[model samples]
Target: MNFFPNFANINECLEWVKRKDLALAKMELICQLLNHPEKKQKTIHIAGTNGKGSTVAFLTSIFQNSGLQVGTFTSPHLDDWNERIKVNGISITNHEFFLISQQIMSELEGKVQPTIFEFLTAVALYYFAEIKPVDLVIYEVGVGGKYDATNVISPLVCGITNIDYDHLNYLGNTLTDIAQKKAGIIKKDIPCFTTETKPQILSLLQKISQEKQSKLCKISPAKKFIFDSSQLITNFCLTAKKHTFNLKTKMLGQHQIKNASLAVNMVLYLQKYFPQITQSSIEKGIKEAFWPSRMELISQEPLIFLDGAHNLGGIKSLIQTLKTFFPAKKPIFLISIMKDKQVDKILNTLKKIACQIIFTEIPETRRQEISKLKHNNTAKFHKITDYSKAFFSFYSLLDNQKIGIICGSLHFTALIKREFLMNLNEKLNNFSLSNHQPV
Candidate 1:
């Protein structure tokens, strides 16, 4: 009956990431405690080096529009904790979050230990079962696939969103090793989908798929409209065998256009098996799914933007998106990342488009040392110890004609978005009230 505190709910989860133990023991323990015999649910397990989040967003939205009750769980939340778990796009309420935390904490107190990811996965699955029994659940893997807590689900669809080096410390150093770990989601006889892949990764995936007797479908990045990011409303088209449909993405990036196709391919695959999903529903779902913080534009003056390009593949995509979207202009980057990341590679890429740069720390033990910026002379630098200071400092530099992008890590982006910018309008209203004269 004891309620968990706000700090317990937020930092408790974030702290687990630092533990760095990748074994599935904690996940299985939580599952054993909370999972009921009656609540077995089908899911779609999504894994990749990049694009899995966008893919999950697209698929989740599509399933929701298909008129099927849908549950979705994604990680590295942006702006809010509730953003990680949703039923038909409705985030779990604050009271519900506390209640679930109480239950989860009770179950894990001493009898079983659970990592933050495992604990949250338990809460999400339990919530999905109790609140609304979803016809489909789409889960984005927190890290690698094999040991990922979400991997336990019997996925109706498994997607590999293109493999690359990420979480190398745990997953492995080689691309083949990483691909193998990700391909772990391709369970026995489950249909799998992938984006256009490299030769080595594709071979690894094919071997795994064949071993499991699962059919693998490689999604060719269909030529959509030539993306003109200069346009306010960026547009594209995907031509399929039966029909060609014009598509407009709420999210920016050519990578997102490819992600939309990956979602489309998965939805089409889902329909072939589910039968109830119609073409109209598919279109509606893709168009409606909204994933924030990836190439998200916060304000125009001094042009504030944020993205979680923590890895090389994601950084490449982000750079490409920035180039396409901004065209001739350059953007100043306010960036920080985790200690474990390849900072050299990331900085090398940033130097290409970074008009100027500022160094900062994220609110975590794993945040990269701000002193690392001392070596880079290609751009200006400042070390901001806390996020509030970073935000105010970055805002001050906005010249009204230039742009500022916050990048490098998802965790950093999430904190900046939630703490500084999430409710700017509401805060401004309060400030106005204290200053205004009686009317």
Candidate 2:
């Protein structure tokens, strides 16, 4: 085994973004060479078109509250690459990431060339299994579950958040086709849970689970929901496995209620293995768990929100949340989407609630051109090549009567979030300095 030539730093590892052919054989071979790190921990595998990250966050917080060591692996990090791997809500340090990468690359000895995600998956498995072992590990599927890099793990429990039309290029376009692909995580006699309620999709999932001899728990939406607009919290009651549990969460939108319910059900199902998780931990965890860039309120004075609603389904949910929370008021939207996404449908959906739209470019090759984002709608549209300039231009127009939302691609939202936080901090610092009198 030899170290990958010229791989000096973590950035070098992060630069391998080219996605290779989607197949499990390569990842299986890599795991075998690494001595089966995937099988060394209690695991829960999650796959879906959306809500995967939120469900993972809810589960992580729940297990942590139970006083168990929990490790989580999620994707499309908002800020740094290390965010993809975490133990007890703490990301892996860059030094640790580099060391692990070096070890895995040396072991492979150039015999196997893994995509960026594959390499990162290997790193996460090794880190959890050998370096920093935990009581349980939760894995989020990178793409469709059938061939996703994370599918190699035989998890104790599996969950599919919901089936929708996403990643149409790789997964099929129809809902049934997509549902089958996501249902791939179900293993023999392992209980699977989902929040998907569509009859057709549920039937397909039921068929697949029956074939695998797995019990598919179909979670219904909350029986009742109450939202506190002033505090931005939701309280709901959910019944699963003939037991009813009351849950509350800070994550906004009607969709999050379903996500939180699914997490609760999965945790309850796993109590046989982890009996330390009590109702108190589940309630506390649901209340405290938070994931950024999903209906996040960055500012309340001018009412600014940032959401990563890139697809049509997500955009529809965003629209619903806007209507429910701020009815009859149109908010200005700042949006940039990936080229591969259904740009027209997403823009059209946003138009339903947007008083104005500012189209900006994300700092990536995959971003749709600002010109293509324009649509003929009543809402005033402006195209700005630079996102910072676009944001400032939009900010100048906001007042108590006007609100703003930054959305579209998660990558774009991440960049804007950093800029917004930095700008806000600067303003606060200046305000404090002006108010101080040498005290």
Candidate 3:
């Protein structure tokens, strides 16, 4: 795994914008030019508004522990491009990324320009085929699965987690509309799994599956999960079928149980083809799987947490999770969101749990500048100009007995994490932060 890619010095990686161009035609051309590298491995395509990353993490850990070489392609890297394309849990090395990137550049240099997402998807597929092949590829849909760049692959199994309002402009405005976009990944005769319970959304997905001749296997959680919450870890006694499994995860939200349940059923369905994946492996893999920046508690003494709850539904979950853990108090929150997101809904949802809120923008063009926001959270709202200072204030308040949480876009979470980490390495004489406590 490489810390930084070779093109880190170049501006192409970060400067490439991911806009509203959603279609498979462009990706089809790029893959044809690259000789169709996506056919290298069998795939299980996972798509959802929230829990896609965590679900991917659970499946990756389970398959890898079963002794299978797993290749996972996820989107919106928290740190860098290398974080997006990974093989067997290791990020594609800078050399590997550079090699594939050059090949892509040569093939589509001037003949046809590719979008950032398209170029990266081509690089990942090429890397998987020509560079290093794997047994399975746990591919996550970038945004709406309908015409996402990664939707080019024909997967063996398609899984759609619970769908809600998200990507309203690109996917659709209503839940049914969004569900249709995610169901686009269901291929002809492929088996599908889902945790979607909404009647309308479920009906839409089932209809798509039937039209495609695919089997939509919906996995419903037990009547309820028995939660065991300690100081830091949260465990759930999840019962599926006659057997009960003690599932443990570092994630804070109860929604993870549903995600884990979906992963469990998918592994079970794959048993005929993959005899190595067993019940014990599933239990161990899920317990150990950790997806960063999603309910991630970085420190305890000052009690700072980070969750990438970028949308209304995600924010609601974050609030509920906090209520479950810290029943009686409000946590100080530092948030940054995109300009295009539903600002009012997100803020209203947070008013219940956020004692004090600081709104700041990551240094990006799409960031929701503090001045550009139209929010209605009645809490003690403070808008800060500098993101670093916002994070600094949140950290400085750790010792005051109020908990801290960072939420909103994953990219904003990434920037704040990077800034805080960078602040840790500086000399105390130059600047001070949270009394410099170690996790």
Candidate 4:
């Protein structure tokens, strides 16, 4: 604990160790030492392979719009560590983060050495319980649900947002194995919800819920749905418990319809417990909820977009969104991927619609090597180790007829986004200066 005395040293802590059996037990011990602050707040738990972040966003917005102070915990932030914890869509300030870290360090008295995620989980729970108490807290499972550090608290309701084939090394290979691991969040008599429609997965979730004597609610998009990119919004209708909801979301892609619907259903179910949530609040929340790097449009002139479609499921969704929005155009893809992902499958999938692919490397150690990212068609592929140069090369080739997409890894896209915004700001500043001088 002395080693983690400050906010800066928090990142230096160990991320994970090989011992999976002891992870939950260790977390339980640490919570016990801190008097179990995780139990103080009303909670909702969500776990899945792809849509967890988006679902969390939708739920956070919904509760916030209802005038409830809501605390949210999510992972793998794009730019800042503070992005992992928020209340009312605002991240915890650095000073607050440091204060909580210090309190936890002093309470533990160097008896327990927790991983970075473990320590952060403790900090978030404490913040919501004591530092800035809220009406409710939402916890997004960092990985597979069963042993995830956040699983220590029993939630008012839990959800699984369409499990798929990502995190194979930790969750297992087959769909059944992955579903079981995600189902680990289900608690005794705590109802669960899911948007997964696959029959086999649904049956497994049903069985697990029944064993725990908890009702399993399945959510799906309405057959009548509309997508109008003219205003970059989707209009969909959902019916839960015979009450119909006309919903609209700015988040693109058909998959988002399912994610938003799941959030709506969860909110509807919670209305019995928290009666203040109105239909108007739900509509406003769905409209305003935004999650970055998920089919985010960075520029309109060059028609550039950034997506975090690093897995097979995510890549399929990204491809669907691209085709639906820009049917006639084949995009120039600026891509980089992690070595642990299903690289061949993702690359093969993107190649189907990509007019050309520019490969680049991010600064992360886990990034896939540029030499290994090659296709059989040499004419369609180009490799540049530097991300900035790679992006400019792709940018130079853009025109009214051609579009650009920066995708593959969230980490890579985040770096390019920062670079793009900085350059854009510089250009605007120079333009302003020249105009003023001439006048």
lDDT of each: 0.76, 0.86, 0.80, 0.86
- Per-residue error for 304 in candidate 3, Å, reads 1.2
Clashing residue pairs for model 2: none
Q: Which window of 10 residues has the lowest lDDT sum in candidate 2?
A: 430-439
- For model 3 the local lDDT of residue 369 reads 75
TM-score of 3: 0.89
How do the predictions measure up, each by TM-score?
0.84, 0.90, 0.89, 0.90
Error in Å for residue 251 of model 4: 0.4
Candidate 2 has an lDDT of: 0.86
Clash counts per candidate, in order, are 0, 0, 0, 0
Write down the RMSD of candidate 1 (Cα, Å): 8.8
Find the 10 residues in a row with the least total lDDT in model 1: 430-439
Q: Rank the candidates by TM-score, best first.
A: 4, 2, 3, 1
List, residue by residue over 72-92, the lDDT tens digit for candidate 2. 999999889999999999999
The 10-residue segment of model 3 with minimum total lDDT is 13-22
